[model samples]
Target: MPKIQKRKIIIAKLIVILILLTIFAFSCDSKKPSSRGIRISETKTYEASLYRQNCAVCHGAEAYGKEVDGKQVPSLRFGEIEKKTDQEIYEQIAFGKNLMPSFKGQLTDEDIWRLVRFIRRDLQGKQQ
Candidate 1:
C-alpha cells in the first residue's frame, strides 16, 4: 500500500484506541486521578435535579442529612463525609451503613457516582 494509506490506518487505530480507553476508564471500579479523571460534567444541573429526585429524601434537600424511620442519616453536604475517600463512600452506598439504606439495586453505578459528585462539588460548601 501507499505511505498515505498506512498513515490513515494508523490514525484510525489511534482514535479507536482513545475511545476504548475512555470507556474502560469510566467502567473501571478502581478509577483514580492517575488512572482516570472522573469528569464532573458542566451539564450537571441535571445531576442536582437527579439528586433531588433520588437522594434528597434521605440525605436531605441539601444533603445535610435527613431523618427517616426515626434514624438520622449524616449530612453528605460537606463536612467530613464530603471529603471521605470514594471507596469509603461507594462502600456505604453499596452496603447500607447505619441508618442509610443501600442504593445498590435502586441506582446504577453511574447514578450513584453522579450523586457523589454533586455532593462533593456542588452542594457541599456551595452557597446557593
Candidate 2:
C-alpha cells in the first residue's frame, strides 16, 4: 500500500497497544474493599481541599479507595500506608511509584510535606 496508508496503520496499532497496556497495568483485584470511611466532599479542611484537587481522582475523595471498571486504586487510609514513615510518603509524592504520577515539579517541597501531614494527620487521624 502507499506510504501514508502504511504510516496510518502503524499509528493505529500503536495506539491500540498503548490502550491495552494501560488497562492491564491499572487493573486490580476485585476482592479488595470498594469504599469505606469518609467521603471527600465532607471534609472542609484546607488539606482536604488540596487532596481533593490532586489525589481525589484516583484515591477517591475520602481516601477510602476507588475502583473504576474493575481497576482498583489503593486507599491511603486503609493500606500499609500507615506503616510507612513520613519520609517514605514524602518521597512517594515527590517521585511517583508504579502507576502513581510524580508531583516533583507540580508541587513545592513544602506543599508535598503538607500533603504528607494531611494524609497522616487529617485522613489517617494520626499525630506526627
Candidate 3:
C-alpha cells in the first residue's frame, strides 16, 4: 500500500476509536443509579409525564384509582404497588380492566415500564 494511503487508513481508525471512547465515557459517567437504584435517567421523567397524561384522569392523577364506568379501580399510591409485580401492573395497564381499553398499541414497553416505576414511587402509599 502507498504510504499516504496507509496514513489515511490509520487516521480513520483513530477517529473511530476516539468516537467510541467518547460514547463509552459519556454513558458510563451518566449511568449512576437513581433513588430506585435502577440506573436509568429517563425512568422518572418518562413515567411522570406518562402518568400525568394517560393515568391521571382515571387514577386521580396520583395513581389512586377512581370510579369510572361505575367500577372503582383500586388506588395505586406507594406500597400499594409493592403488592403487585411490575409485570402484573404492566398487564393491567396494557390490557385494561372492563371498560378501559388496552394501551399496548399506544405506548412502547419502555414508556409502560417507566409509568410502572412512577406508580410504585409517587402514589403507592400516599393516601394509606
lDDT of 1 by residue, 38-68 (tens): 2222234777777767777887655667788
TM-score for all models, in order of appearance: 0.55, 0.65, 0.54
> Per-residue alpha-carbon lDDT of model 2 for 28-87, expressed as tens digits?
645444344345576677777879888989888668779955788887985889889999
- Give the runs in model 2 whose Cα sits over 4 Å from its true position: 1-39, 68-70
Candidate 1 at residue 82, lDDT? 52
How many steric overlaps are in each model, in order?
Answer: 0, 2, 6
What is the full ranking by lDDT, best candidate first? 2, 3, 1
Q: Which is the winner by TM-score between candidate 1 and candidate 3?
A: 1
Which pairs, if any, clash in model 1?
A: none
Weakest 10 consecutive residues, lDDT, candidate 1?
A: 33-42
Cα lDDT tens digits for candidate 3, 1-128: 99999999999999999999999997788445433323222345666777777876776644546898788766665345567887988888888866667899999988887777666654442221
Q: Pull out the clashing pairs in model 2.
A: 40-61, 40-62
lDDT (0-100) at residue 8 of candidate 3?
Answer: 100
